[model samples]
Target: MEIYALYGPSGTGKSTSALALAHKYNINAIIDDGLLIYQGKKVAGQSAKYEKTTVQAVKRAIFFWEEHADAVKEAINHYPIERLLVLGTSRKMIHRIQGALALPEIHHYINIEEIRSSAEIKAALFDRGTQGRHVIPIPRIQVEQDFIHRLIAKVDKIFSPKKEEIGETTIVHPQFQTGKIHVSELAMKKIAIQSCEHLPFIESFRKVKVDITNTPVVEVDASFIIHLGQNVNDLANTIQQHIYDAFLEFMDLEVEQIRIVVSHIQIESPAHA
Candidate 1:
């Protein structure tokens, strides 16, 4: 197998840039953060981000567990992996992964600095340090199905140099991120209430419930008293979006579902009143 390694410090955008580099080299598979991603889908191995602690996360990344290493190796053998791209924080880390999986030595090494500018690296680091954002080079659904992390957004389209869409990437806040705040459901309800009030058509919320049972994946149930005039469908969608944006902005938690029900409709528009 022809193996290539992309090495960089944590939060330097290695994972973010993995697809572009893979496209450049026509690499069909990528080993990132202890996950085996093939053709933009996670086929095998667990993500290190799923680990509860940083130490455990690092161990997972380096395939410290025997079962983890065996699973990834078995997947590699099953697939026609002629060329592979492995992402790590250093060449030694790449070597560690190679040793764990019993893969061939890296034929090429690409540093994150080569593909990204210094300014870009700084911005990535800032996002990681402040917002605790991590990028996984796979579709959002892939992460959502297997991971229990705060999903920020899914970049559906990643264009290559030829303007051809390469693949999807998901942004997430892992459980082990430092300085992760704990916001009460009441605070989330307040945000949802404020979101409803911002809409001119929404008079009041009859009920606002924030379900945090799933932790990062929250569900919001909001019943609003809306004014009559505008289309109710448009109004409901606007309320949902507003509340979703509010949670993402104020609390940094992505509300998975924002259920909006028009409990009552006022006779006149708020503007007319």
Candidate 2:
């Protein structure tokens, strides 16, 4: 079990690089905040795209993170500190945790500060909505040499998952491949809600409040797709069309990319699925 910690200033591509490492190393389990995780070969993580920059949105994002504590803890325990390839920043936080946990094999906390260039460190204002700064550096924290050694041991575990989960092509995580894949033009919270209105899936849906123009990115829970339609394929197709048009109508451009997160799937119900 090997734990490689990747963290740097925001937008430094820590998560992105971690994903790439996972794919390359053939490792499993990536734990992070604001990620729409799923059980599949590949998962698309998402955050709702917003047109208006507001303080409320920032609070909500933070609140949502607090809510996932149990889920994250479970994932860490199941895999142990050894197997986790963490996208983290709080060294003091991680250190305190390390002191508490009595796992001898858990070694390795590879800080990604080595990758962040000085150019990236320079601060610049970004159009990121309610969030503080789009990309801010997390100050480096010094840890004791003894702790570093212990962490290193845990990280060097037997690479589990027999057979080649990722063959000759080793790119463990998509996030590592690039920065967040956001359809900025389509920033909507509700999938079926937005789909029903612009795309014409359901008859009754409230209007989406966020601005779609200028910013064209959107967010969706890939798993939580519409199922209560007459036909699933028809719903899927209609949903795709709606997402496309919304991008054009709001953002006033052709949709270059559509990042889907298959996080939620509508199950069959007594009324309809």
Candidate 3:
């Protein structure tokens, strides 16, 4: 596989702009913070951001643990990757990840200075130092389950010059500031059910499944039946919007995705046949 590196100091917006860079370079897989990201999905390995201390986080990032190294290596072997991007603070750090993953020698190097302005770097560092926010190149759904104490936020959508949507990035606070906060799956299900309770055409919710695996940014799968004569498309859209708005208003949490499935439709009968 062809290998490329993006080298820079930590918190210099490397991770923030990783997706756009990958699009420009045509790299399909990325190795960042000890995770293997393919096509915007995390397929294997735990993130270094989950480490409790800076030293341990560094160790995890460079694949110091045998299990960690082996897991990422296995994932690389499993996927048919053509080109890969390795992100790190320095060439030495990139080389360490390369050796750990047994990838080819670096075919190209892209420096943070080439991509981000000095002002942007300063802003990023300020955010990192004061807010403890770190960017993961994958989407929020990919890393939500792994981050409990951290506040997770999704980066805005990026587009190529031609207007092709590249993907998204996630901001996370890795260092635990407060104790772990737990939001139960049942609670989320209730929220989903309650949100759609008042919709005109929604007869009843047949099944509601809330995935807290990705905490803070939750994914809801709701199966319900709607009254006949109701436009399925319109009902689905309204239900999705209601659930999303409800979560944001009530819990102050972002709804990453809501999938509304119409399992049945109720048709009203005339007085006489």
Candidate achieving the largest lDDT: 1
Which candidate, 1 or 2, has the higher lDDT?
A: 1
Candidate 1 Cα errors over 4 Å, as ranges: 180-273
- Model 1, 175-220: lDDT tens per residue? 8886744556687678888776766666666677776432233333
Q: Write the per-residue lDDT of candidate 2 for residues 1-273, one digit (tens) a residue.
A: 565555554434454345445665545655443232222121322221121333433322232344444444444565423355545445553443333332233355556656533322221112222222231011012112111222211111112245443311111211112233344423444542454455433433323333333233443433333434456555555556677665445434344334444444545554553
Q: Is candidate 1 or candidate 2 better by TM-score?
A: 1
Clash pairs detected, candidate 1: none
Clashing pairs counted in every model: 0, 41, 0
Candidate 3 C-alpha lDDT tens digits along 175-202 = 7333334556687778877887876566
TM-score attained by model 3: 0.63
Per-residue lDDT, model 1, residue 266, is 58
lDDT of candidate 3 vs native? 0.77
Ranking by TM-score: 1, 3, 2
**Candidate 3 at 186: error in angstroms?**
42
lDDT of 2: 0.37
